[model samples]
Each structure stands twice: as C-alpha cells, then as structure tokens.
Target: MKILLTGISGQVGWELQRSLMSLGNVIYMGRNQLDLSQPDTITTTIRDIKPDLIVNPAAYTAVDKAESEIDLAMAINGVAPGIIAEEAKRLNAAIIHYSTDYVFDGNQNTPYRESDLTNPQNVYGKTKLVGEEAISSIGVNHIIFRTSWVYGLRGKNFLLTMQKLAREREEIKVVDDQIGSPTWSRMIAEITAQIVAKFQQNPSDFFSNKGGIYNLSPSGKTSWYGFAKAIFNDDFSNNERKLQRLIPITTQEYPTPASRPAFSLLDNQKLSDTFGLKIPEWDQALKLVLDS
Candidate 1:
C-alpha cells in the first residue's frame, strides 16, 4: 500500500515515520514538499502520488496566532482538508485525518463524545471544526481522530515549554481551571499506525463499517497545573538547575487571544470498541516520553 503521510516535521509526524514504516511504502511529505496552506499544491501532490491512504496530521496549529491570522489558518486547517478529501475520492482512496478536542465549547462537565455538538470558541478550533466538516461533506472513506492536549519531546508543545521553563525559571505558573488529557504524540502515531495496519488488512470492510470520527485521547484527565506537576515529577534527565516552585493559576489569570475550552477531555470509548485499542493513562504516557 502506498501511504502518504504529511507533516513529517511535526511531533506526531516525526513519530509516525517510524511507526508507519512496517505498514507499506510510506511516502512522507514535510511542509516544503506538501504545504497544506496551498490548495493547488495539495491537489497536485495527492494526484501525483496517488496513494492508497492519506494520513494527514498537518494543520495550522497555532491556537493563539490563528486569531490574528484567520485567513491563513482557515486556508490550511479548513480549505486544504476538503481538497485532500476530494483528491482521495478521485483515486478511490481513504484518508485518516487528525482533529482536536477544542471543537467543543467545554461547557459540559462530561467528556465529549464523537456525536456531541461542536461549538468551537476560538479561531483555531473553528478552523479545525471546519476542516472536519469539509472532509465529511466530501463523502469519502475517512477516519477523523479527535485528540486532546498533544505533546511530545521534539515539538514546541506544552510538555517542552514546561520543561524549558522548569530549567530556566525559579517558578512556573500553569492554568489549573482548564482540564484535558495530555496525550503523547508518539502514542497518537503508534495508534494511528495500528489503525492503518487494520485498514490494510481489509480496506473495504474497514471503510464501509468502521469509518467515522473517534476520540483518540488517553484515559483520565488533568489540568495544565497537574500535567506540569507530572512532567516535573518524571524529569529523569540529570541536568536539573532551577524551578523552585510551581504556581497554579486560573484561566483568566493567564489570558490569551484564543479562548480555550475549559474542559476538552475527549472520550476514547468508540476507538476501543471498534479497534480494540486500549490507550494508557495521560501520566503513564508522559513517563514513557520522558524516559525515551
């Protein structure tokens, strides 16, 4: 199977290069080779490659920056995905796209299911939701995995930010009011690879019966402050310098241009029920990432 994987430079993409290798001829595309912001480039590339499956983890992920750069964000996050799905439909191929938990308003106390109504509060979330809609509207075989609070060692995520701050500053402040499951990027990649492998086994049945949106987050939840605490607690590297105290602050205390969902925990029950993929806890995934 010819698998076209996008966002090679991203944390999940970087990990996917390794996980998806055994599946088939993985044709990896970084931003330079396949920029999602450019629609013609996306259409041309997919047409040229003619992959059996297109696994897109790429998007305009700058949550706060999306507020200022709405057009650019929408182009990549919203328009590009529709183009990809269209191209995939032409080739009679399937697509696996990654989405975010931010699509919800976070008003509900319970974890958001796949069937829950999406009311994105910020530009980034709105754009992501638009992308999801675009793909589904195209009437193609697709698997949209909605994940939450993704972090890894390589990327500029919350995990790396917290670690860098811990080393440089005497104290750090993280939002405590907001709740989510801090999923490891590698875990996301691995699970995605598993799904792809399953798809390869029986593409027709997989798409006919199992194609839809599923939450792909780890079990359990925590606030930003709790995640920070877990990261610091699992810091196994010998180079420890500063970080005297860790301060927990409310969301209003640390304001941002983009309004995040106060509670964006995604329920992964559908994923387990369909794929039999039992993900680990958020903290457990964190420890594995740190250990590596």
Candidate 2:
C-alpha cells in the first residue's frame, strides 16, 4: 500500500514515520513540501502522490497566536482539511485526521464521550472543529481521532516547556483548574498504525462500519500542575534540575489570549470497544516518554 503522511516535522508526524513504515511505502511531507495553507499546492501534491491512504497530522496548532492570525489558522486548520478530504474522495483513498478535545466547552464535569455536543470556547478549538466537520461532511472513509494535551520529546508542548522552565526558574506556576489527559505523540502514532493495519485487513468493511470520530487519548486525566509534578517526579534525564518549587495556580491568575476549557478529558470507551486496543494511563505514557 502507498501511504501519504503530512506534518513530518510535528510530534505525532515524526513518530508516525517510525510506526507507519511497517504497513506500507510511506511518503512523508514536511511543511516545505506540502503547505496546507496553499490550496492549489495541497491539491497538486496529493494528486501527484495518488496515495491509497492519507494520514493528516498537520494543523495550525498555535492556540494563542491563532486569535490574531485568523485567516491563516482557518486556512490551515479549517479550509485545508476539507480540500484534503475532497482530494481523498476523488482518489477513493482513506483519511486519518487528528483533532483536539477543545471542540467541546467544559460545562459538564464528566469525561466527554464521542456523542457529546461540541461548543468550542476559543478560535483554535473553533477551527479544529471546522476541520473535523469538513472531513465528516466529505463522506470519505475516515477516522477523526480527538486527542488532548499531546506532548512528545521533539515538540514545543507542555512537557518540554515545563522541563525548560524547571532548568531556568526556581518556581514554576501552572494552571491547576484546567484538566485533560497528557497523551504521548508516539502512542498516538502507534495506535494510528494499528488502525491502519486493521483497515488493510479489510478496507471496505472497516470503512463501512467504523468510519467516524473517536476519542483517542490515554486512560487518565490531570491538571497542568499535576502534569508538571509528574514530569519532575519522573526525572530520568541526565540534566540537573534547578526547580525549587512547582506552584499550582487557577486559570484566572494566568491569563492567555485563548479561553481554555476547564475540563476536556475525552472518554476512550468507543475507541477501545471498536479497536480492541487497551490504552495506557496518562502517567504511564508520560513515564515511557521520559524514560525514552
């Protein structure tokens, strides 16, 4: 099988390079090769590749910056996905897209199910939701995996930010009120590969039955403060720590351009039931990443 993977420089995409090779001949594209913001470029590139499977991990992920760069964000995160889906439909190829937990407002206290109503609180979430809707509306063979609090060794995520601040500052203040799972990008890639393997086994059956949105995240959840503590606690690195204290603060104390959901924990029951995959806990996944 010939597979086209986007966002080679991203955390998930970087890891996907390693995981997806076993399934097929993977043609990976970084931002320079296939810019999602350019509609004609996206069309031309995908048409040239003519892949049987298109896995899109590329997205405009700057939450705060998206507030100012509305058009760029919408183009990459919103409009680009629809364009990709259209091309995939033309080729009769399957798509695996990544989405976020921010699609829903944090009104409910319980973990969010796949069937829950979405009410994005910020521009980033709104754009991601648009992407998800576009993929679904295209009526293509697709799986929209809604993940949360994604971090890996290579990306500028919360885990790396906390590690950097730990070295530079004595005290680190993190928001404790906002809660979600801290998923390792590698795990996301591996799970995606497994899904693709299943699709490979019986493409038509899988597409006809299991082609929709599924919450793909670790089993447990935590606040930013808790995640920081966990990172420091599992300090497997050789570098010396300069952090004296890790302080917990509320969301109001630390203001940002984007309005974050207070709780965005996604329920993985649907994904588990459908895929027969046992997901690791958030802390366990964090340990595996830190150890690596």
Over the stretch 165-204, how does candidate 1's per-residue lDDT look in tens digits? 8789887988999999999999999999998988888877
- List TM-score per model, in order: 0.97, 0.98
Candidate 1's C-alpha lDDT? 0.92
Per-residue accuracy of model 2 over 202-230 as CA lDDT, tens digit each: 98778889999999999988999999989
Which lDDT values do the candidates have, in the order given? 0.92, 0.94
What are the per-model C-alpha RMSD values against the true structure? 1.5, 1.5
Ten-residue region with minimum lDDT total, candidate 2: 234-243
**Clash pairs for candidate 2:** none
Model 2 segments beyond 4 Å from truth? Answer: 234-239
